[model samples]
Target: MTKDLLGRHRAVLPDWLALYYDEPLEITHGEGRHVWDADGNRYLDFFGGILTTMTAHALPEVTKAVSEQAGRIIHSSTLYLNRPMVELAERIAQLSGIPDARVFFTTSGTEANDTALLLATTYRRSNTILAMRNSYHGRSFSAVGITGNRGWSPTSLSPLQTLYVHGGVRTRGPYASLSDDEFIAACVEDLTDLLGHTRPPAALIAEPVQGVGGFTAPPDGLYAAFREVLHERGILWIADEVQTGWGRTGDHFWGWQAHGRSGPPDLLTFAKGIGNGMSIGGVVARAEIMNCLDANSISTFGGTQITMAAGLANLTYLLEHDLQGNARRVGGLLIERLRAVAAQVPAVREVRGRGLMIGIEVVRPGTDEADPQAASAVLEAAREGGLLIGKGGGHNTSALRIAPPLSLTVAEAEEGAAILERALRSIS
Candidate 1:
């Protein structure tokens, strides 16, 4: 059955739309943190569909909300007054921490970020953008233009002249050996020098944690230091929180809070988890910037009634249950467990991430060379052992991405870790 589906998928889908495993499993149903494939093989879902399932699989609250909203109305374009949209927007704005914030919804992170780019470019009247190296924002033209990861970025043509910035990955770079403070200074100096050679950029956009680049991140205060430089030059700061938002990072509600010395970003974009499997994405900014567009604009499907209801329910559940705190506690233990497992495996290079968004970089034993084969081997092995994880990185896709739902429990974490440990040992 799985083979038949794979054959049909290859026949119909774009080759670039990648699927996992030697034989990709069609996930038929899920409950809590576990999912069953069409063959009825139950696997612990650690990736949570790239971390979209923020709470739990088949969560009752989300299901109820979606069902009730569908019964009422599924969609009413931005043309109509959406009560759920407004409610979700109000909640998000308050949680966003932006002063005098305004919210605009989109169906995906790409659109949210595209909207952000539009706002920044129009407000600053600049076509230039600054993005972190090894970053993946979205697949849209404008989003891809600012993406610095060559593996993910398909084209060089862009409406915005994007300048790649340093300091997104602290472990590898010209300043990799520097102390945290020194690294921040070096990156700031590099940015300053880059600015000297180019026109004033509209905004410096970056992911607090590079998701597709293998959960890489800079030193904690690096962005805050850069914020000082950008602020002096009137350049906006846009935090791409698609993977790092809504308390996935443990200590911070938003990943930018890791660099909260400078307060909130001028613009913040988020998606993935807030809807708990529903498509919900948006940008939050001060009214001045969000209101910068002179002409009219509305997303045909953005903030549709169904998605908004889901967002409202999911956000409410996340906050009410303090899933952020759960992420902190459980994720901390999970990382520690994985680190121990990695220590015993020669091919495991490094385990890094905050809260639930962790990455284990695979490398050749006793060498810094990326080991993508080892990553693939481990991924396949884990699946055989009833665990579902993900792999990605800028360096030949050699890192295992382990972003589980924020509501992960301690016992489930241990179960998943044990399976992963066995998988790593099998590959090693």
Candidate 2:
């Protein structure tokens, strides 16, 4: 049945849509932190469907909200004044640190980021934009224009003149040899030099922790320093918090807070994990920036009633349960466990990230060369051991991404770590 379904899926779906594993598994359903495959094999879920499952699978609260809202109304597009949408927006606005914030809903992270770029370019009156290297915003044409990762980006042509910046990845760049403070200073100097050479950019969009870039991140407060320089030039700062928002990082509610010295960014785009599997994405900006567009614009299904209900319920559960704190407590233990396991394996290059969004960078046994095959082997080994994880990196795609639900339990973390240890040992 699974093989037949895979065949049909390939026949219907685009070729570019990639599937994981040599024999791709079909997940049937899930509960808590575990999911069962089509063959009735249960596995602990670590990737959480690319971190879209913010809380947990089949969370009762979100399911109940969606069901209740569906009974009332499925969707009353933006043409109608949606009560649930307004309520969710109100809650998100207050939660968002931006003062006088206005929220604009979209259907996905790609749309949310496209909206950010539209607003930034319109408000700043410039087509030139700045983005970090090894960064990925989304798949839309406008979003792709700013993406710096060649693997994710399909084309070179773009509407915006994008300038790639340094500091998103700290370990393999020109400043990799420098100390943290010096690295940051060098990045700032590079940015300053770039600014002098190009037209004033509309905004500098970045992911606090580069999600697709192998969960890599510069030192904490790196953005704060950049913010000081950009502020001086009247450039807007856009934090692409699609993968790092909503307390997934443990220590910070928003990823930008790691560099909070300059206060909130001028714009913040978020998606994935907010709706707990429901399609919900949006941008939060100061009223001045959000309201700059002259023509009327509305997302027909952006804030549909059903999705908003899910968002509200998911948000409530996340806060009421303090899952962020859970992520911190459990994630810290998991990282340490994985690091200890990695230390014994020369193929395991690095263990990086915080909270639930940890990354394991695998390399060749004796050299610094990225070993994608090793990463793939570990992924397969872990899956065989009844664990599910994800893979990503800058260009090599050799980093193992482990982002379990924020509501993950300490016991679950340990169980997953033990399975991962055996998998890594298999490679070494």
Candidate 3:
């Protein structure tokens, strides 16, 4: 029977397609913060579908909206406007405070980033761009061009533009010695140097808080300084809120606001939390830059009626229930617990992040090098202990990332922390 199902599924998929996941666990269903695999084993989900499922799996309102939209009309080509699309854009703008900000919808976080980069490149009419070291943008030519990781390079290189690398902020260890002010100053200086070195560049793009880069938040004053420097150089600043946006961070509806900066970027990209999993991303731009476009950029699948409904409902649920507040309360508990765990365990290096976007760096005992194996052991042990977690950069496999659903409770967070503690102790 399993073989029959496999054969049937195989018929629907392309032979050239690849499976990118590891240690595959077949999932059945999820409710709130708990997911059960095919074997009926429940796992506490600390990894919220790569930080996309903000309100939790199969949220009532979000699913209901999607269902209603699907029953009505799932798609209306860009030649026409749909109500859900209109309402979603309006609500998002209202929440984001980007007055009259026009939106261009896409299919994924990477696609939104790619679109933002395109807009900046066209607006600035420049060939060079700057990105933070160790940042993960997207795999497209332009995105890969600006992404700072050399590991992304392969047989094919991007033809769109040249990339200039800048220093990402560091707040701990060798980077710890520098005060927040010092670190921000260094980033500003490095960006300024890069701007001069690559003059007339199109834009400087970065995550408000480095997401896959170990949930690292940039130093204070960094975004303001970048905006000032980039604007002075006639360059646009693009905020990639792929992982950090949509209330994953507490207090602010968008991660960009969590930076506590005043100036807004030329363009902003969001995807993960927007659709609640229905494949939607919104690109909101400063009105001036938005009006600069000559024609509408439409997609075959972007912002379909169903997608808009799901996203609008997801954002609504996040607001009505004040999930951001929950992210604050619950994420605070998780961070504090991890800090306590780190203090107790020698292998645990640091716990960093705000709200639900948390990372715990597990250090090797001998060389002080990042111990990815130890991190893997911890993740596996957490699974055995009935919790699910993810990892991030700092040594691809070394940094343990814990960004659970914003709806996760304080008690659940405590359980996750306890599981992490047990896992770390066993490894040590």
Best by lDDT: 2
On residues 1-428, what C-alpha lDDT tens digit does candidate 2 reach at each position? 98999999999999999999999999989999999999999999999999999999999999999999999999978998999989998998898899999999999999999999999999999999999999999999989888989889999899999999999988886898999999999999999999999989999999999998899999999999999999999999999999999999999999999999989999999989999999999999999999999998878889999999999999999999999999889999999999999999999988999999999999998777899888999999999999999999985547999999998988899999999999999988
Clash count (model 2, backbone only): 0
Error of 2 at 39 (Å): 0.9
Write one digit per residue (lDDT tens) for candidate 1, span 115-206: 99999999999999999999999999999988888888999999999999999988887898999999999999999999999989999999
**lDDT of each candidate versus the true structure:** 0.93, 0.94, 0.77
Error of 1 at 1 (Å): 1.9
Better of 1 and 2 by lDDT: 2
Q: List the residue pairs that clash in candidate 2.
A: none
- The deviation in Å at residue 272 for candidate 3 is 0.7
Ranking, lDDT, top scorer first: 2, 1, 3
State candidate 2's TM-score: 0.99
Model 1: runs farther than 4 Å from truth? Answer: 395-397
Q: Write the per-residue lDDT of candidate 3 for residues 94-148, one digit (tens) a residue.
A: 6665656888888888888888877887788776777777777776677777776
Over 4 Å off in model 2, which ranges? 395-397
